[model samples]
Target: MAALLEYLPLILFFAVYKFVDIYWATGVLIVTSSIQLGYHHFAHGKIATRHWIFFAIALVLGGLTILFQDEQFIKWKATVIYAVLAVSLIISRYIFKKNLVEKALIGVLKSANEKGDTDAPLNIELPKHICEQLNLMWVAILAFIAGLNIYIAYNFSLDFWVNFKVFGLMGITFVAILITMAKIYKYLPEDQS
Candidate 1:
């Protein structure tokens, strides 16, 4: 549900492109992204940082595409967003001495604890090496995605690029998540009694 909502703009863009054209599709992307953001804020009481970033990117790049009557801006949007995220994650890990993945995992554990899940594997702190490795993994993944987007956009037809953006990227991301979970599974705390 949330995953589908996150991809609503891209899905709408692809569908609109089929019915109309790139410019009109870009317009629909911007509108749908805005609506998705609004819905998140309304439901969650506060928008997540990533949601805000994506919404801003969609609006700005989509608007540029529509304004200039060029699809290039929209085509580069994914690469730009991924690059920004990769850089931000790297900086957060190195400069700020924070691992975003670890923080998020800890938050989930805390939430579970609060919900009275007594058996939850609540680590007081994620191991530093694990945090660093996970952060680097994410950086590598995002960089790969950014490069992949550029490669596809430049080498493939617009139709192929649109399909890749909607389906290929999502499939890649899902696989990456599964791999990450498998790698970290051993690190999770085991019940002791």
Candidate 2:
């Protein structure tokens, strides 16, 4: 159910585009994106920066698409969002010297004992080098996705581009997640795995 909700906006946008048109699809995308963010805030208590960024880009670009009656604006949203994310990750790593991937995975710190010094429960401690590598991998994937989106949006037909946005991009993200999991599998404690 959570997974479905996570993707509800994209799924709805695709379905609406099939039934109506790009304009309607863009409107639905904005509304559904907002709903998704609200759902996240309600369920998780706070919205993540990436989620906020995604919604802001969707709203601005989608609004322009609707107001100007140009699907091109909406089409560019995906590319811009992906590019911004990739750049953000690169800056976070290179400029800030913070590995966002590592920061994301190291959820709430908990001392497993009375000493308040042990972190045994979260045994999945990935090495710093591994985290840096994973961060680089994510940045590379985002950059590739961003470039591909622009290429398809320009070269392909409208319907094909919409389909690519809804399915192709989502499929890429799923595959990336799977690959990342496989990459990190060796880092997990044997007893937990």
Candidate 3:
């Protein structure tokens, strides 16, 4: 798909680096992600919030890796980013009483409602309590997945790490989205039909 192609450079770098040096691959990743971030910011009017955070963390970790020549820094980057996001999600749910994931998802529903689509708004609605519960569910899921990533990266090789970074993350996220969709679908208002 076109979306996949847009990330080809990153994918290819990961593929070609199996026998190549890690620094080269790391450099390419940093450069490519930075460029991609710039492209999004200039064309899309705003950098995606989560991705921007990911890139910033990657940038910092990449710099540390280069400076110290320690692969551990690069390896732990995944752990740190995942932990930060997981903690943020958990804190938002428990402390702030917010569901950031749901808010992002609801933007689509809100947009449909704003567009005066009678049927669209009905497709997604929930009691406030269910919304909060679902949000907490997502936070738990994210934390679990983050911990899983740490396990894989620490025990596995670089090739596996790269593959997991691409395919594994995508696969897990797709599964999560499906689960979320199933939960939301049941709660759709009868009027939406």
What local distance difference test score does each model get?
A: 0.84, 0.84, 0.72
lDDT of 2 by residue, 16-80 (tens): 99999989998999999899889889988999888888899999999999999999999899899
For each of the candidates, the C-alpha root-mean-square deviation to the true structure, in angstroms, is: 2.7, 4.3, 3.5
Please give the TM-score that candidate 1 achieves against the real structure. Answer: 0.87
What is candidate 3's lDDT per residue for 1-58, written digit by digit as tens? Answer: 4376356545855765675766777777778778777777777788887768777876
Summing lDDT over every window of 10 consecutive residues in candidate 2, give the lowest-scoring window: 107-116
Of the pair 2 and 3, which is ahead by lDDT?
2
Judge candidate 3 at residue 45 and give its lDDT.
81
TM-score of 2: 0.88
Clashing pairs in 3: none
